[model samples]
Target: MRLALVLAGRYPDLRGSQVLVQQLADGIRGRGHAVHLVTYGAVASGRPGPRAGRIVRDLGLVVRLWRTVRREAIDLIHAHNYEAAIASLVVGRATGRPVVYHGHNALAEELPLYFRARRARGLAHRLGRLLDAHVPRRADFCIAVTEELGEILRRRGVAARDLTCIAPAAAPCDAAAHGPRVGSEALVCYAGNLDGYQNLGFLLRSFARVRARVPAARLVLVTHAAPGALRRAVGPGVEIVRAASYDEVRARLDAADVAVSPRAERYGFPMKLLNYMAAGKAIVASAGSAKGLRDGVTGRIVPDGDEVAFAAAVVELLSDAAARARLGTAARHAVEDPRAWDGVLDRIERVYRNVLAARSAASTDPEASAPDGLGVAAE
Candidate 1:
């Protein structure tokens, strides 16, 4: 099948959505399907750029996307996020192609982070909710990164049959191959953006408690954000490192003794958890974000925003080498299981085939006039 993957951001960016888009394109191509990516030419930052600039760029993207669909005779359109989905819906309608919307995160929870002003943020969030409630309904099918997110979609009027929950997966990384250890100090690493939803303040307070118990333990944060910003957030005693590539992040994770994700959000899955699991590192993550993780099996799962418990979990794993090794091994094994990318793609491929089959059938029927609207189809 020929597929067009669409995203409303710069290609090959450091963001998780970019990583997911790249993975999907590669996976689809590896399965012998042709895939073309459509994305904005401009770079996007933590904050949204000028509204006028965004509108112009999006217009250009849609034009390019429509041309690609027509020229390539694309059979399916798979769009990521709201903006891309809107564009795909428009193109799919024009080209008579089915669209699959891949929802990475709940916009209602994420939109506010883009605006600095409280009033603007509130307005953006309200608009986000409206999009969330309406956009997926336009797609032929929807993919949610977590079951919690699938539930949110259902609440927003998306039918269960139209939704598939496929968590993100990470390629396996060998932690032992990355040269000698950087330092003897036991390193606890957090590899992601310092977004407000990440609960870094709680992480800092918890890490401070961990420092009290294990004075030699060090916190290493690997992100694209400025080191000064992280230093200000966590205060003194934390080391910040910026890694440009995934290879660098894996190397740093290889050097670390423990990985932490203190995200307080419940709607979406953290892509970093997959990296941590792939690195075979003992993880200390919040219960809400660590969806598939078992409390004492794959990794330690603490209640959200519980700094003392979160700190204790990290310190305990850091102190016990045997337990850390056991959990880390289990975490790696979990990712290597059938739920990994190979299996994930298997399910996604089925969705694509089903959508294609339904469309083919609908075209042959005299009464059928494009399979419009959103809802689940029988598996």
Candidate 2:
């Protein structure tokens, strides 16, 4: 089958969405299906320069997507995120093809973080909800990154048959292939964006408590922000490192004694958690952020925004080498379980086949009604 993967952001970007798209494209192609990527050439400059700039960019993206679908004779349109989903639906409507909307996060909860002004944020959030409610309904099928998100779609009136929960998969990490690594000081790393929903302020408070207990323990942040900017937000006593390439980030994870994800958001899954588990590092994450993780078996899960418990969990893991080792090993085993990338893509491939079959059957029978949007349970 020929597929067009549409993304609003730049292709081959460093964000989590980019990683998922790349994996899906590669996995689909590995199964002998043709996949073509259609993405904006650059990330949207967040500056509030002119609304006209964004309008023009989005229009161009839609035109390019339409041309690509036609030229490539695409069998299906698989779009990621909100803007890309809208564009895919437009093209699919024009071409009379089935479109699959991959819902990464509920924009209603995420968009407000981008605006600092109170009135602006309110307007943006309202607009986000409108789009969130309207766009997914138009797709032939919807893929939610987490069960929480799938439930949100259901609550918004999307049919149970129209939605599927397919969590993002982490690429396997070979801890031994990189050779013996010199261990650094007892370090805890948080590797992801510093957005408001990430709850980094709570992390800083928790880390401060951990520092009070273990003065020598260090807190390292791996993100795309400038060091000076992060220093201002996090205050002193923590190490701020610029985000590195994926390989370098994995290496850093391998070097750390404990990996931390302090995100408090309930609606979206944290991709960094997968990397920490794959690196065989003991994890301390908030309950909502640690999806698929068992409390005592895989890693330590603490209540969201509970600085006291979060700090205690980190301090405990840092203090006990044997316990950390045990948890790290378990975490690795949990992630490497049969439900990794191959299994994830296998389920997605089934979705493709089902949708195609339904489309074919509908085309052949004029008396038949529209195909039902069936949901595939996550493995």
Candidate 3:
């Protein structure tokens, strides 16, 4: 099958969405399917320019996507994120191709974080709900990243028959990767972007309490994004370091004694949680972001927004080597399935086949194209 993977941001970037798309492309192609990328990187200047600049880039995406569909004869359009999915739907409508929306998170839940003022956030949320209700329903199929997100789509009116939840698989950490080996007695690491949704403010506060109890404890923010104002958010003992590549990210995780994810959003999967597990590092995560972890088995799960409990969990793990070893071993075992990637690809291919078959049947029967009864279940 030939596929066009559409993204609004830069391709091959360190962001989770881009990383997932790149991995899918590599794996799908390895399975003998062709995949092409459609992104604004060709026409846009920065990652995301100002308001006016963003409007222009989005329009450019529509034009470029249409051209790519015709030029490559793409059999399917698999779009990631809101803007790219909208653009793909437009092109798919005109080209008579099937489109699949790969939902990373609920727009209503995430959009409000971009605005600082209460009124602006409320307005953004209303607009996000409108989009959420209207957009995914128009696609041929929808793939949600988490069960929580799938439920959100169902509430937003995406038919159960046309939606499925497929979580992203974590790539194993490379032992040979190069990164800093800090000398802190106990190191706590968080790796990802500095976006508002990361809930770094909560992390900083919790780390401050941890520092009070254990002065030897240090928190490191490892990311590919520029720290900018985030450096000011860091109190003493917390530092942000820029990671150049995934190898460096893995290396940093390897050197850390404890890995942490403070994200409290319940609708999306935190990729870093999987990374920490793959690295065999004892983890402390909020209940919302702890996807595959069991309370005392895989990793420590704390209630969201409880700084004291979060701090205590980190301090406990740092002081108890046996507990850390046991939890870390369990966490590593959870993601050690060698066939996980193949299973993901197989599921995605099934969706592609189902969508294509439904479209074909609709072309002949006319009344068979309704999306209300076309979907595969999340296994």
Candidate 4:
């Protein structure tokens, strides 16, 4: 089937939503379906054509969507994030096509909105929940990344039966990425944006303790701002690296002895664990991180903020080659063998099919449902 996936941003971007858009496109296409991506790009620059190309890409992205939706003859519109979901809502209304909203994270619930008062936090939550409920109603089905998130959608009034799971897709890289044999310097890798709700500072303290025992341990920070904004943690062995491509990241995973995740449980799903698992690396993540992992089979999950336990897990994995190898093997196999990947994609497709079916059913019912004004005007 031909699928038009909507992204919350433009092409040549590095945000989480963009990455998911690229991955979903790759995965669905791998399954023999045609997929096209729509995202924003720079437009209306003060500089001339070539130079101005970098200004306000989001505006150009809307134009791209307008043209592509018509040119590609897309079968299903799949919206990846909030803005793109709004775009899909617009396209679906304009063209009478079925739109599938793939909910990646629960930001409206996890964080505040519109800068409301402290007393309004409860009220803000109610509104966020309401928005979440209304946002995906336009779609035939809502695809959530985790069961926890799926439940959030349901709590906001999404039909439980209407939600599907498409585990985030991660591509594995070559062993050469293992990087120069890793040596006695046990390297720990953390990759993601340092901004927003991610509690990296907590993880740094945890890592310091780990370093005390494992003196040769090194920490590699690959974040959008870490290389510049984040000061080096007070440690001798820690090393901060800038963000790398999929290939370079895989190489780091291939080389590193262990991977760590210290996300606050209340924040959101740590999609990075899936990436580490896909690369066949042993992980030392919080229980929140392990939520998506299979535990003893895939990797160890410690309680959130338990630096001693978190550090111990890292050291244990670092010290035991056989256990690390075993866990790493399990994590890799977890992606493909007897796991729910195929089911995940099937759920995604099911959402599209059901939405189309219901929308078709609706066309005969006389109320061609109007578009919900969820998509925010591009900034």
- Residue-level lDDT tens digits of model 2 in 177-242: 332334887799988766667778889989999999988989888875444444786745688776
lDDT of 3 by residue, 229-313 (tens): 7887799888888887887787778888899999999888888887788778899999999998999999999999999999999
Worst 10 residues of 4 by lDDT: 370-379
Relative to the true structure, candidate 4 reaches a TM of: 0.80
Residue ranges of candidate 2 with Cα displaced over 4 Å: 42-54, 173-181, 225-228, 370-373, 377-379
Better of 1 and 2 by lDDT: 1
Give the TM-score of each candidate.
0.89, 0.91, 0.94, 0.80
Q: What is the lDDT of residue 259 in candidate 1?
A: 94
Which candidate tops lDDT? Answer: 3
- Candidate 4 lDDT over 19-69, as tens digits, reads 666766776798888898776642221311112353345345556676787
By lDDT, the candidates rank as: 3, 1, 2, 4
Candidate 3 structure lDDT: 0.84
Cα lDDT, all candidates:
0.81, 0.80, 0.84, 0.66
**What local lDDT does model 2 show for residue 21?**
85
Locate the minimum summed-lDDT window of 10 residues in model 1: 172-181
